[model samples]
Target: MSFDQLASELVSRKRADLYRERRVLESPQQPEVVVDGKAYLAFCSNDYLGLANHPDLIRAFQQAADEYGVGGGASHLVSGHSFHHHALEEELADFTGRPRALLFSNGYMANMGTVNALVGKQDAVFEDRLNHASLLDAGLLSGARFQRYLHNSPESLAQKLEKTEARRKLVVTDGVFSMDGDVADMPAICHTAKVNDAWVMVDDAHGFGCIGATGAGVAEHYGLSVDDLPVLMGTLGKAFGTSGAFVAGSETLIETLIQQARTYIYTTSMPPAVAAATRASLKLVIAEQWRRELLKSLIQRFRDGCQQLGLTLMDSPTPIQPILIGDSAKAMTMSAALREQGIFITAIRPPTVPQGSARLRVTLSAAHSEAQVDRLLDALERVK
Candidate 1:
């Protein structure tokens, strides 16, 4: 808590090349952006289906603002639950094939609130080693006996769950590993959870608007149902191209969260206009199948190009492709070099990733053309 110690810690981080900073984005979230007064072709956004700045979404937001004003003035438990929020929740439930869906302020709050609501001191919370920070933090903050298994390994999960004697057991994972871009083995994980008498929770933040035949996400992509993968959480800010998150499950589960989840209970609901915008984006996510197809094509194109370049790529079929740079400084150098060439790709380092496994997280979107992807590849090759 002392000022001197904080300054020393900051100096240590800088010396270790682990200091982090944020860039000022002047433009809207899209493929092309202006960062710190410089124009660049950005590949770091989570706008997978290219709906972040879509005209339809903009119009819906504008119309909703005209009708409902801007803010949700109070918590959902108070007077903040607008018709727009209720309608979006219902639409999300239908979209995900769930019995009910409860909206939260964001993905982090949804994960934290859900885990804490379901588990307690006598319960057990198991998670993937490489899950999103939100999931990891939720598990720790739940005050349950938290344990993490190897990344995406059902066998590792089974080994840990078999010995758990808690009153309730919850196994959590990301539907699509956000950093690695690979998907969790949903069928295998669900089977393991069943054998251990534990429920499964999947946070499909990066999958919902880009995967499956109808963009139902990893659960639908693997043909898993509400019974197989119970507790589905997705973020609207990512693939949905809106802002907020939700948890979908049976009626009992959602109602339980509404009554017990502190995060949901205390936080103000998202703007009514944001919910309306999500409704519009949801329509495009389902009706405009071309976006998904285009994203798939772009992923394939980038992967094929990287393979030809012999770049170290993770086994990811999703839009979140990561190139392993191994060293943190090297990753940072590569990122700076790419920016110098008019491309913007962020270098992801520990403790976000494991030590000695720093990487360049190259994400794709439906908005990017094939030529743009090739340009990125060209820049990467030149940097190399």
Candidate 2:
């Protein structure tokens, strides 16, 4: 019963290669950040809208902290839910054009809580093979019969659904694939779900404030309504540039989660100051549409540059652009070379991505300049 040998065994097996060792970040989340006391142009953050360091958000957080105390102190079902949280939920519901919305401490909890609450032991849950780990984990924990369809293949989902004999079926997928940088085929999936009498859910964590007109996310991009894909989950920490997550859906869905979602009912609510900051982030995401435009231009610029270099890149129309390097060690080597050039793009290896398809997840932000993109391209060419 010696537990101390486990670390040695992992290191010996080289499975420790999959470990992510975070660098010490010494500044706010901006286009440029100091890591390990070295300045670098960071391309690894989910802050697509660049509002993380906005002056207005900081001021709102400061002001809210002065009014509301720092800690939430209790769970939402108790006395933790504050006016800030309530206002943000209302704003989110309105933003997503849903009847109601409920907030969770983070996107992981939001996905887990919603899926586990909606599907029971006897139900069937079908997910994309490449869906986020949180969604897959929730499906397993829900005691439902879990199945995975081929990535982005509606036909595969239909086949799986046709075989399942459960009375209730749910199909969930990531609106924007995180590591691949590609979007889910929402229209096809929704159509398949409708034809199969299955409910569809979209975790639009990367799309909420970065895709579609007014940043309404993937469903809106595909012109799907609440009736088409009823369960929508988005994270405020991504494009919103704050912390926390929300599920936007029909009134019944929200009320049911409030009552049955163990993660939502048991965990202490997020700080009101974070909610206040998220309110500011939401405002900036909507009013400052120029940010999204700038982000798009940067993405296009990088894509065009990568194409010119003949580098292997994914076909993605969002800010989460990935450069596919097939070998895990090769991807890590490329990432390290870029880091030496003061460019921070993290290497995503298995089991986050497929074994042979590890990549450098080069995410873009509105705060980054065209010159910076060009510099990244130049550095990439040198490394290539």
Candidate 3:
């Protein structure tokens, strides 16, 4: 259809809600930032560790730029691969306790690359109903018989699995749901996959660098080994305080993706400086335990305060605590009300969430202080 026709159709169906406007940011990612010339306490970022503005990471990026001269200059398969990328990949392998690791330009690409490469037309892919859009899209692109289970329900997964007859069965889920902030029932899901002889993959985009023992992510959080969950995906931008993402698994898995994953082979590599900064950030994420602890405290404080206010919060123990507002208009109103008080939070509506389940995705960061959490709670109470 013509672009104008498509635009009109969108407006008619109210899918024009997809048209989001962006505000110009004039400062580093922190508790407060300058947006559209107004200073606001920003809660919309994924920088859970609050290391995006750390001086050490900044120095690491600057030093790497001085040495490597910024751009990667080519794709990973070409001349773009550098020492910074190599070192970071090795470090990530170590971080996840995997035999090898491979980097991708972003989390979306990583998910698409791994899922598409691993399973093809002959396979069947089962996913959580609320998995990230990337996973669902990847399954579609794979030409696999894609099916979805009820969110975080292993019984639902098994019922679907019982009917599938593909040559290979794959189960994928988000480690920590981005909007709901709840963790997957990994032990149950992984156990089900194991009994069915299916492969399990987890996209721990929001969990890595933020959860588990020593920040090893969801698998570690639940004490699942590489055996229980063989495929692991993590994004560096969220908590590692840098750009890009990685997949850690068996050597054969890494090599197969390197050889077969179109997304990994065709795209330009991430900046070498970013890899350097990720390395530095990884160090801090491990060495300094206070950040995670403080985040845990903040999450508890927010949840407790919300319960006291009688808000319909989701079942979440993580930092991404979303307040479920069933009406999209109400969600938007809550967002605007908070913004008026200098607090910035994004309202998530369908189809990012289900219809009639729009919400304020209140993300907490380690940079947030007790006073900041109280201020946010006070503002929410006023508007709610």
Candidate 4:
């Protein structure tokens, strides 16, 4: 690999307006933020319930840090699992209505470890085409026969399931598709899997702390028990406003991951302080029904505003609302236009989305006022 080749590729990416950059955040994870020395009303965050900078979580984190120190010091199997980690896992298992739950450093590791541990050379894996990158990577690396069905289409999944003769069959999907902001058809998908004698897994990374009556995620929202969805993977970073991830499932499933999952066996545990903070976050997520209601109202208002502006949005009931723009460069330009108006929305382009389906991914939070949403709508009208 020559350096010139890399430079040429970078230049080509720039020409295509596909180059990526990071903006420096000078404030907490809130609606109003200072990025790159400029203050903007940003809508590109995943903190749906707005608990990231809450005082309770902060106090919990600080107290836990004072008691437990900062670093995990070792892998969970090698003496890193602290009281906070164990308690959080138990709390999470109860929260998700699962028999047991296992914690991982992040969602990627949780998905990778669980899938690879469950399926092997003689087994097969099926996933939705629009699943998050973590699920796709897990399926590919599981050493199982991997197949993809149509997005949220149980018929497509059934067709694939019928053709496979592997010793074990696993069906996987996102409870909530991240980029599109649409909920998966779990009732249909799970039924298809059950008839095929396949186990179902749902990565509810973007669903929890926002959906469901008590914020147990899509599983609770759809009334699916642990029997309906076996391997449940969820991330704390997004909705919980904390860091780490977990897999809630049967006792046998968790034991299998603990014994066979290479990622979990080899990796260091997350900080105890983070786990302690997540405990606080979980309490707020469950108790605050008003937060969910406010999110719904905000989403509806944004959707109605988009309709009035004739802006085509995805069929998403979640807090994620993307305005589709066909051309990548045009999408980038539109994002820049919004930034100029002191509203920060990033352009989502190819590889993240399909070619010519570039979009401006507008994520909302309960922290945002209706006036802020109106300001965004005004910016959209002007940008249009």
Off by over 4 Å in 1: none
- Best of the two (3, 4) by TM-score: 4
- Model 3 steric clash pairs: none
Which regions of candidate 3 deviate over 4 angstroms? Answer: 13-18
Q: How accurate is candidate 2 locally (lDDT)?
A: 0.92
Worst 10 residues of 1 by lDDT: 10-19
Error of 1 at 117 (Å): 0.4
* TM-score to native of every candidate shown: 0.99, 0.98, 0.97, 0.99
TM-score of candidate 4 versus the correct structure, residues matched by position: 0.99
Q: How big is the positional error of residue 361 in model 2, measured in Å on the Cα after superposition?
A: 0.7
Cα lDDT tens digits for candidate 2, 203-310: 999999999899989977888889999999999988898899999999899999999999999999999999999998888888998998999999999999999999
Alpha-carbon shift of residue 24 in model 1 (angstroms): 0.6
Question: What lDDT would each prediction earn against the true structure?
Answer: 0.94, 0.92, 0.92, 0.95
Which run of 10 residues does model 4 get worst, by summed lDDT? 208-217
Question: Candidates 3 and 4: which is better by lDDT?
Answer: 4
Q: After superposition, how far is residue 92 of candidate 4 from its true place, in Å?
A: 0.4
In model 2, pairs of residues that clash are none
Residue 76 CA displacement from its true place in model 1, Å:
0.8
Give a tens-digit lDDT track for model 4, residues 252-361: 99999999999999999999999999999999998888999999999999999999999999999999999998899999999999999999999999888889889999
Model 4 scores a C-alpha lDDT of: 0.95
